[model samples]
Target: MSKDFYSILGVEKTASDDEIKKAYRKLAHKHHPDKEGGDEAKFKEINGAYQTLSDKQKRQQYDQFGQTFEGANAGGAGGFNFDFGQSNAGGSGSGFEDLFSDLFSQTGFGGSASSQEKVGSDVAVDVEITFEEMALGTEKKVELYKRVLCDKCEGTGAKDKNTKTCETCGGAGKVHKTMRSMFGAIQQVVPCEKCHGKGQIPKEKCSKCGGDGVVRDYQKVNIKIPAGIEDGQTIRATGHGEIPIGGGHAGNLFITIHIKPDQNFKRSGDDIVSKVKISFSQAALGDKIDVGTIEGVIKMKIVAGTQSGDIFKIRNKGINREDRFGRGSHLVEIQVRTPENLSRDQKRLVKKLQEAGL
Candidate 1:
């Protein structure tokens, strides 16, 4: 049975060029073989559908013919001569260097043609740190399992040093196939599954990497955390991820920070809030009291006749700004405690004073 390209990509037949590309990218990322629970067959199917719909002429042909386009290839193999290098190889001054230069510029690969190579998959790890560490930076060493290129095969996945041209695609790395449609014929070129688009086959397979060119091993990485980092923040380390198949590039490592709460102090934006209890006499008569702050214990003065529930601000006693902009003020909420019981002598003295009205 023929597959519906539009339905495969979850898009309409009349979708715009940008819309089609966007849908293809989304599906490709979701169904990529590197991802967990990914289906290789579904990924290839979406790739094939996108390969046809992304081109202007092919899409027009498919719109008119439906599924018969598979028969359009000259040899009925359902392939097309796309000449992906045509744009660069054309003109009198163009050459392989120019072709590679253009490709590298678009793909962010540096001078090396191998820079176009894909990197390995990325891995994510969650870490918990104390609030003090979040306030002040900290370092962590984490152990992770990741794929690394096989040293024996040098990432070629071959035990023997020799390599031969692929027999399936004749070193072209692609197979030509034609599809017959009611409207006409559509030709397509697909990557050879046996050679995996490499257009070459190794003489022997590497036992260490199982012909996959990657081995799973434990790796230790050190992460330096900056001060004032917030909870749930993520930090990325480039090239510290899983190695790609056949030794392309390495993926990134993402570390999510989880900050633990402090028991004594509460954070409010950039400031720190805390409470202090004082005796009723202390509230009535001015006195110096020691309070805990981020820096340390600081002495704060209580004004005479201070009421309960009154707040006192200590300058630069709060949490430091993450950006080092300045320190915040610490607010201390005062609570007054009254005497639960009074002695008989104290009561008698209070009664005598009341009677004298002195």
Candidate 2:
């Protein structure tokens, strides 16, 4: 049996669209996975329920057929493709056929049409930075060979900034297309080949771009990498990706940061951890030793009677904290070294001290 979406949202079947939207927003905010005490499964269920109930057509179909529509729940609520299969319950196919045509047309299925253009494609790039750069933050310039707006046309694709209604689509931006499917002939409304859904064309094509608003060219982009950013973290720069062929909003550029490993230091959360070797005399008698940190070398005191694996902290010597004020501490682990290759006289002195229980 299908789950009752109305019950899931705590609303009546006749609830208004505004009521459903309000309920969805409240529940979504409360159950958002990023929030404290949020339930991921419950949030997805809420989203799925809201997805069907919020759409007037889908809601109507759900009310009539429950979850019987093929591909309705595929990929959860994020999936948009829906297939209203042939009705098995005996009845006139007129209602279902009308709905099929309406559904396909409004939802970009078959023989149906839309006026909206697809957005541009996103681009991703990897950037390698040194450990010091990761701790201090830096900017880098990258050259990308991607689609860029034509310099001569200024993204208009017209020679004199003049355009005319598309002759192929007759300014409708979409044309009818028919194909055979399981449910007999399905006509699809698709974007016109000539105007590319813009319903307009340049009177004179750009010599550089050849009527397309964008051209393949090299573009230099400046990226600012933030301090304390972790490896493999991506930063999105909007409008820096490839523009669509027919000219829509440019996509985003995702930069994944790769930090080079440091030989001496390792980052743990906000703190930096490192190991330093101390001699037996230094561990037993106490001494000040030089320790390497992100902020250069610092003098750290080793307490008397310190044992191996003892840790000392140098405050404010690690990477800068990105969330709040002040910096992280540097933790230095101590390793006491034992003496080797003792002379006979040295061994006799050690034996005398051992006999005296020193």
Candidate 3:
């Protein structure tokens, strides 16, 4: 009886390659033998299903003939020569090797041997920018005291550029091992311990970094903050963190943005809000008044009988919108101020107006 690969992986027949890979990863992690309550049989089953569906040509063949395709390649599921004494998890030698390779490339699955190579650690830093700077994009230069690639060996970790390929794994950076499990013998590919998966070793280690290919030093990194970036938003600076030892990809630098509060303006989504004080006369009659905005102070009209807390908008003067082509509006709130002290003549005029019911 042919195995249903799609059903085993819990994916539809029309599932995309990413969806299949994701399903396989989830199932593989859940059923791994090394973990508590892990099922070796189920892990093997998931690997087999992933092995058949991940390949384009093999998937087409399986869709057409299940596992009984005529003249199917020896490396595929249809041509497996089952040995009851051995693990039936793989069709041929290549299937298990391919499975390990694919799994290792995607994520780390811990084992007796190294499943992943050592990489540099990620670094995070907090950056403070003014509210005006957040409104308009700006760049900041931050000094980081961390590991950087060695200058003497240029990250090769060698003396006078002297190096040789690792003999244990034959420069492949990985080696194959067979282990007995509940299901039977399973072959796995693991990182070579001799060269630490670097594939090469320095004949004489670099004096400055002691073969690590990195040194702790101070470096200034420039981080660009996008326009209208919110507080607590993070910006990733790729390849700017710690450089790996013995030469690998560098890790990333994460910059968290902190905006300084503005005394005159407050942020509300894409718009900015500000309050402007107007005298009672100005509120009672229509007049033009200067209002504060993010760009600058601009003239705004105050209509007759304008009440306190009335809002007016100044278009295109708020934060810059990076996603689209435009700026947000600036909202101005009116505060009407009553006269505190009145002269005798002013009191007499008010008294006369009050008498007339003005």
Candidate 4:
């Protein structure tokens, strides 16, 4: 229902085509329904807005009419159109597919379509790593229990496969489906159930996988977690997920990383921060102490008359850069701990010093 295409794409009305394209690409990637925490509703809205604004003629008409006309002035063969319950069963019906085709092409998103086979659905998993492990890239093996293509059948779903064009969808991999609505029957293009969007079916079903072309199995996939990867970021492992329902490019496995917090160190940019406590005597008179760094424990000096909240830097003692060419400095903050309980003799000595103004 949002009429402002510019506001939907987060751009000014006078924004250029490249600016609009940049905004659209960024927003589409962030809000893509395939990503975690993606919003499908918002994705649809942005798609509609971008579709209108991306066209020069449509953009001009939309600007003049302010979406109230919805470009009804241009009812030409090439202009965008939306009509329900009017499409015949034999002729082509349009709705979701038309919009998705245009948006997917513009956004450069693959795996949405198929030629001879269908791509599989993506799989997502969560992984946890220690701070050290995150700092240094590591490899891990993950065991996944999901549908895999039948090895015996070679994903053709038949011992000796012979393909026949699907009569139901007429080899289109999609069919016009009509559903009743309050206004009337709404028709939309949906994947054909019989052929499963492959546009063809095997002559005979495989005994092991039956006609599905996939079986429930366990697969071990080794993932190379790179250094400097942020938490909540997803890593896509190509062809490491479930096999396509019919057969095409295998789906990607998306791994979301969670980093465990370290007790002694905290991350700040590329630097590591840690706090150390020193006695009042060490702060006032200065002392040498062993401080822990990412490399190891090193002796550090506490300057004389150092006050609380003093910071000391250890060069190149923090996390390594992604390229491992250099490292960030470790910052150590000092806290002075005063004596909580004093003996009678100690109190008397302190009182004498106070009286002498020492």
Q: In what order do the candidates fall by TM-score, top score first?
A: 3, 2, 4, 1
lDDT of 3 by residue, 46-85 (tens): 7667767876677898899886753353344322322222
Candidate 3: residue 15 lDDT (0-100): 97
TM-score of each: 0.57, 0.64, 0.71, 0.60
- Candidate 2 lowest-lDDT run of ten: 88-97
Q: Write the per-residue lDDT of candidate 1 for residues 17-47, one digit (tens) a residue.
A: 7777678777867776656877667866775
C-alpha RMSD in Å of predicted model 1 compared with the true structure: 10.4
Model 4, residue 42: distance off in Å is 25
Query: lDDT values of the candidates?
Result: 0.70, 0.74, 0.76, 0.72
Model 2, 147-189: lDDT tens digits are 8888888876888767899999788675656655432344445
Model 1: weakest 10-residue lDDT segment is 95-104
TM-score for candidate 3, residues paired by index: 0.71
What lDDT tens digits, residue by residue, belong to model 4 across residues 312-349?
99888777766767877889999999767999998897
Candidates by lDDT, descending order = 3, 2, 4, 1
- Kindly state the number of residue pairs that clash in model 3: 0
Best-performing candidate as measured by lDDT = 3
